[model samples]
Target: MNAFRTTRWSLIAAARDSPSRAQAALDQLCQAYRPPVLAFIRHSGYGNDAEDLTQAFFLRFIERGWYAEADPQRGSFRALMLTALRRFLSDQYERAGALKRGGRTVESGSLLEVIASDGQSPEDAFMRAWMGTVLEHAMQRLEEEWSSAGKLDQFRQLAPLLLERAEGDELRAIAVANGLRTNTLAVQTHRMRQRLRQLVRLELLQTVGSPEALERELAELRGALDEMT
Candidate 1:
């Protein structure tokens, strides 16, 4: 069937599985969601410890049967994940003096590290963490849609545009370089924006049970973005 339809079904199937199946589903979901979560953690002041903490959180989440407590009727997955991360951070901070550092550090690191090392505040770090999570969720859904539709390469080609803001001249230059007319590039940009919005909505839907939840999430995302600026 269609990729969009498949994504919808996959989400439902994943949510309704038996224990073993649920674990598999959660694994896939985590794979899709982990990068942004890691970025968020790193931005939230965890630094080199982010990856290890993120992994530990997931391990404990599963071992503690956390997924079984997921209440789709109450909140979006993003919110729940953020809440989990917040609790993890609080606990880690309280035990910071006692906890021994372990695990391989992320070599390439995240954008948050660059921002923090530049002397950004903890509030900035918090907002960046949220922004990274939202962006990651949006990108993951977009990638999944593209992969399912067999247009993964096309999406990859447009990845830069997806990640950053584009000026009109810059977009025109890219269009010309790619052998496309400016008007065509404009349309493509519009489509990309729409897809991004849709991806965000799809993610919100997974955590939220209704349109109102999506609205709330969009507002939160916007607020976080504003904080970064």
Candidate 2:
């Protein structure tokens, strides 16, 4: 939220001294970007071979102190991560022959069976995966919140209307199904939509380094969604 508030993400700042804290921050960063990174590797032509490389890249990324180079003044975390991932892949292909996943050592393969060459670049694959991850996080937060309140059934009934433009008749039908008045259901749908936006904003904030960058990040997300469709 605030600069002082976000100082805790100083996981990198404490990294040279505190290994545990640095690992925590690295884990947070990886959790946010892992989906898109892996998808980009896959679309780059590695197919399932991308999985092991993805894991190896992350291990090298944190273990090698790459987070120390994060320059918020330069760009979004997306750009930084992609740049690092590209470098990691290049290095892997250049020096290393195989990557270790768990106990098994898997060898990297060539781009033979292309998965996303249908008019989409690696950036497109990253955007698709990132957007899907964002939506999934929002839906999960919404469900957990509703479930914790013991109103999961209410969330279920209101989810469809919240996501789509439903007619009055359809709203009424959903209201009847949930034993709720049409007016009540409509109001709940509005609130649910508001909550969804809040969840999305919170999730987006985890990637953006500051509150000021949030709107721009959201615009990027919107652009990504538009391109994806």
Candidate 3:
């Protein structure tokens, strides 16, 4: 199958044609991106209302069929989601009084309306949270792979180095504790890191439309992680 057809955004784009598949895609999307959404909402100062706002955002995104407007040629799935979220937040801000009074009001608006861009973008805290979620999901997959291969303990032992956070002394101690030579531990760490990169790439690929977009998203992910550290 063509790569684009397998993307979550592609399933979302098929909302009008395949409601069941599109519904499944929406479920997966909400599950994976909920953390980022909550982070963004809280960072935007929603605080205690973040959970409600996040739920409302996804509800509108699904019931309103906003995903159908996603344009692959414009950017990656992350960008598409962020744009919609910005619009939704802007709409909410316009109705702050109702929201502050503990009332939920999601107004209908055309996705085509030009949302003014400012320094506060989805690329701010949202991008950082999204990248963290991506890395976490990739690591979870790596852990699953290692567990299935009966190397779960090894993976857990060497993961600090794989994440580039292990000190040489710490790694050496772990190697000695595991009854392995430091050189063998080093080799295992290198292989695990390479496998992790591959898993991260696969995770990004499923949400991106093209190779170029994948590269761009990967670069952004790296930059976001750097900012977080």
Show model 1 residue runs off by greater than 4 Å: 1-17, 40-48, 93-130, 136-173, 177-179
lDDT of each: 0.65, 0.74, 0.76
Ten-residue stretch with the least lDDT total in model 3: 107-116
Write candidate 3's Cα lDDT for 1-229 as tens digits: 2667766666676664676665676677788899888777766656556788888888788778777767676778787778788888888776765654676653333112332243344456787678778899999999999899998887787777877767788878999978998888888888889999999898898787777888988887877777756
Best by TM-score: 3
lDDT of 2 at 207: 63
The list of candidate 2 runs beyond 4 A from truth reads 1-17, 21-32, 96-118, 167-170
For residues 36-154, could you state the per-residue lDDT of candidate 1 as single tens digits?
A: 56765766666676788778776665555555666655766666666777776677665553433444343444213444465655445545655566568789778888899997876
Q: Tell me the TM-score of model 2.
A: 0.79
TM-score of each: 0.64, 0.79, 0.81
lDDT of 1 at 119: 62
Lowest lDDT block of 10, candidate 2: 1-10
Residue-level lDDT tens digits of model 2 in 18-54: 7777667667656766899888888777876788878
State the local distance difference test value for candidate 3: 0.76
- Which 10 successive residues of model 1 have the least lDDT summed? 1-10
